[model samples]
Target: MSNKYEEIAQAAIKLFEQKGYHATSVQDIADEVGLQKGSLYHYISSKEELLMKITQQSISGFNRRLEKIIETQVSAKDRLILAIQNHVVSVAANLEMTTVLLREALSLEPEHHTVIKNETDRYLSLWAQIIDEGVKAGEFKPGNSRLIALAILGSCNWVYRWYQEGGKLTPEEIGSYFAHIFIDGIKK
Candidate 1:
């Protein structure tokens, strides 16, 4: 059950991941969607616009989902674990979209990249806040919380590169491993 725009967006994400955003043409996307090249424009303005949409949609979804998890009235350690699991599940569940978002974001125009960068910072700061909360409670060691958040995010983002749809490990399993490493290594 998908609308024309959703269909087009998904196709573009696949093409972007396979051929890259710079190399992917509207014609390529149109072909993938079995639409006449010109008809694709009826749905989307431009390829750059499509990239911006994909970039925005991907990060925005992550932000919303992660924000809800972080806002839960639970221990920072519990919240952090849930957040990590949520991150991995989202990435694993939407591999192509996530891949396109991660790999193609940098090729966006400066203005678009700036927006994505800010969204990214906001998302990562959720992890930092969790870490900071834990430190204040003396449940975790204090250091550079932002650095720790970035390291966790960096490690999780790597899932886009190699996570297979039918891989041996589940997203929960991968996320647990990441949470274990971060929490175990940092806990007081």
Candidate 2:
């Protein structure tokens, strides 16, 4: 994407985070980016399209990083630690986008929603794969990998709701703490 387009997307994310997807207008986004309302369409077809772009970028980033972590030649326990850390750090670094993604994704058109849903499923499956590997290797106790993946992600994804930049724990520290909890919980 061009620098201008990126600027527009960032502006949209900010407005969406502040005023919400349903409440934010095209004019609001245009003003945020110093563009006229009509000119906003040059970069995006509609406000919803912009929402879709922001969400797609967020989920794709998570999947890409997790994919690399999954490919690393390490024990499943170590890999799971890395994955949890990656997720917490990513959520902290991109809080606005993450908030928009979590809170406003359902506002997308059906086709766009389907695209994000698929990407999300792919991401969940990556977590499931790690847990499954740990079970197969006898590192984690045998159980339903899919449900376990959901539980881990449910814990990690909630960081956005209460995260502060200079909070008691850094993102990595929080991530490591979470990793320890999860690893201990699942270990044989």
Candidate 3:
């Protein structure tokens, strides 16, 4: 992507995260990028297209990073920890883009909606496999990996609700705390 297009799309993502997808206008994005309303057309076909672009880039980047984690030689338990750590760090680094996916991806057109949803599902499937490995290896208790996967996903994915970069807990700290609770429950 051209630097100009990235700049404009990033601005659009920030606006979407702040005002939400429906509440934001093309003019709002243009102004955010310091572009004339008509000038935005040179880079994007429509506001929805810009939203699609942002969602695609964010999802693609996240998948790429997670794939690298999967290829590593780490054990399943550590891999699961790495997955949560990656998620928290990614969200902290790309809070606006993450928020856009969480809050606005569903409201997009059907085709784009399906595409993003599929990518999201693929991402979750990676974690499920890791959990399955742990269970099979007798590291984790025997149970539904899918449900455990979603529970772990829910914990990490919702970090956007209260995660502040400069807050008391760093993303690594949050990841560690979650990993401890997930890998070992509170019971004796």
Best-fitting candidate, measured by lDDT?
Answer: 2
CA lDDT, every model vs. true structure: 0.90, 0.95, 0.86
lDDT of 2 by residue, 130-158 (tens): 99999999999998889999999999999
Question: What ordering of candidates by TM-score runs from best to worst?
Answer: 2, 1, 3
Which portions of model 2 miss their true places by more than 4 Å?
A: none
lDDT-based ranking = 2, 1, 3
Instruction: Tell me the alpha-carbon RMSD of every candidate.
Output: 1.5, 0.7, 1.8
Decoy 2 TM-score against native: 0.98
Q: What does candidate 3's lDDT look like per residue over 33-123, in tens digits? A: 8989899899899988988888988888878888898888977788888988988888888899999988899888999999999998898
Kindly indicate the candidate among 2 and 3 with the higher TM-score: 2
Task: Name model 1 segments beyond 4 Å from true.
Answer: none
> Backbone clashes in each candidate structure, one number apiece?
0, 0, 0
What candidate 3 gets wrong by more than 4 Å, as runs, is 186-188
lDDT (10s digit) by residue, model 1, range 2-106: 499999998999899888999998899999999999888889989999999999999999999988987899888988889888899899999988998898899
Error of 1 at 71 (Å): 1.3
